[model samples]
Target: MKAGREELMEIIDLWGYSEDAQARIREILESEDVPPPHLFRYYGDRPGKVEQAERLFERTIGTPHALAVNSGTSALMAAIAAAGIGPGDEVLVPGYTFFASASVVVASRAIPVIVEVDETLNMDPEDMARRITPQTRAAVIVHMKGNPADMDPLMRVAADHDLTVIEDVAQACGGSYHGKRLGTIGDFGCFSFDFYKIAQSGEGGFVATADDYLYMRAQSWHDTAACWRPDRYAEERREGELFCGENYRMSEMQGAVALAQIRKLDGYIGALRANKKRIRDQIEERDGLALRRQPDPEGDASTSLVMFADSRELAEEMMAAMRERGVGVGGRFDQTVRDWHVYSYWEHILEQKTVTDEGCPFTCPYYEGQLPDYGPEMCPNTLDLLSRSMHMGISDTWSPEECDRIAEAINSAVSEVLG
Candidate 1:
């Protein structure tokens, strides 16, 4: 007998792995010939491996420098610190993003000014322009869920205001914007390799930049109290002094896994894109369910596929139904930083200091006063779309058949729940 819809759904996990992955992982684990060391030891003396890793990164990104760090958050923090953005400085970040985007700014001792997002769920350049003032030192454009932010206009605006642009390319490892890789476009680009990411190393990240000074600073920050000497990092070390930051370096084991994953990035990206297209084609006809639109077709490269709901109620209902049928879905950035209670405590600190609207430094009420009245109208498109959006993971492991099954199940569930 044929299985029921629920049965089929239960059998189809979104992230299906190839047999080769298991073999590769096992081969690495069983090897005993001077077994690969963890990152701590690997980075201690195996300078040649680090050089190989850097070469791989350089070839893949075509960037002048790539500083592998512990996490995407560290990359952002180090990059912000290296760029000279500090206390009293305001960095514009999109409201609809992972908390890290804003957290990094706060961690850097700078204030995070929340900006609205456009249809693509990226930072809205118009809102960004309105929020920018004399104190706005930089902007972190988070390519939310692997979709590239509108970089062309964003870059133009940054140039006009003399502001630095940092591309939070953590979610967009293989993504590009206007023929340029996502991380390479901005003043500095950050990438993550957490297990859930497209190009994962179990836990790691990297920062890419063309600026010699910023690159050198990032290296020092990754290695506590360590300065890059020509004899030490020769062809690898780009620039910077001995101002040691925190230790956020990635290990060689993680780097090895990352190197393996990087080799398969293009193929993985192709499979994800193809699967996304199939799923979207099947579900776009359903009512009360909408696919997230990409501004640039070529720029959306990661595997975390997002969709829009007609309303918050509908979105919650759809998510419940999908989960009931064994399909996983997630919400977009619902807890905005401005609404988080932690910011309130920080408010007191800003209150003790002088805040001037002349430049409109930060988003805190103490700085901006009562916060800009952000409602549905201020960002009609994002507000409307977010109320009902949902996301699904598109892993390299899923087959075309599995993707089709997922799409059909989602469509049927939406029809049954909403209709």
Candidate 2:
């Protein structure tokens, strides 16, 4: 029998903030600090929460510099701006990732060239290699669904083409590939601390990088070109032309919650990983299901557990059975009209029109009024994979026993669906 909708909703609500995070937020809010110590003000005199969170993120990600931004979309936009991507530039993006992966490229006034994804649901390196043109300036390698993209080949292709690779680690914080962290491998890595991510602070994002110039550029770009001098708390005005940027700075309150969340990230990842393994062990060898493959066999996965069924009917049957058992199951791509994460749902990008009345990026003389098509015609493999794939979301609060039960539910569901 299937679990009631109300019961299933309760099980899914376990993904956000732990006791520690709540306690920390309470502590920060209760303190009687003057001036609020916001990111808009220099923290040297007050030691703001934003700076504290930035440092913590740097340490956790093993990067030299980490900038806290208002959202993952801002991080991606800043990264592209810092990379000097502008009108007529082309950026390669995975066809199956969150819409922001391509939307950010458009935000940079550049055209996004959609690339196909492999079985791992990551950007296909071979297709990436084939898509390179003289106009290609960069690629955004999204770690979609917490799975790392195959970096070695992606890196090689980037190097061969003299293109910058930005790591979109929005769904993959704390995830790694071949002993290296996902965000640290590329020229720059972006992370999201939004409500549903591996770590959450209500809504916040972080950008990590080892390159000093890129870090400084990202910092300036995120804050509307306000020059940051660590020694001086005030943002120095730029004497020359303005560096392209926006008001994407993270607030002290957001930082407070994110810092606490980062502290618990490792533990949360460990628990989720253990639970994923338990579930995988139970379902991996099932006849009708295929365990999600990873770019690196030994790489660490984030909270989501993915699998593919032999057909769409089999997948739907398994999902129905799991739901009946009070275990939530879902497809890889969101089916809701309000959700616009997948490529097929991005009708805006398919149109390739800018908010500008001039249609500058698309109509820029360098582009000669040309734009790449971003419709289903662009990535057949990604469409096929999404049709047959299903995903199981793991929560940090689930105990070992709950994990076992989830695994049993999956096995049982498979048996009932395929039989």
* RMSD after CA superposition, every candidate: 9.7, 7.8
lDDT of 2: 0.80
**Alpha-carbon deviation at 414 in model 2, angstroms:** 1.9
**In model 2, where do residues sit more than 4 Å from their true spots?**
1-44, 225-227, 230-242, 334-338, 368-370
Query: What's the distance in Å from true for residue 179, model 2?
Result: 1.5
Candidate with best lDDT? 2
**Tens-digit lDDT track for model 2 on 348-398?**
777765787887677777764346765756787887788788887888778
- Cα displacement (Å) at residue 373, model 1: 8.3
lDDT of each: 0.73, 0.80
lDDT (0-100) at residue 244 of candidate 2? Answer: 53
Q: What are the per-model numbers of colliding residue pairs?
A: 4, 2
In model 1, the Cα lDDT at residue 15 comes to 35
Cα error of candidate 1 at position 101, Å? 1.6
Which one is best on TM-score? 2
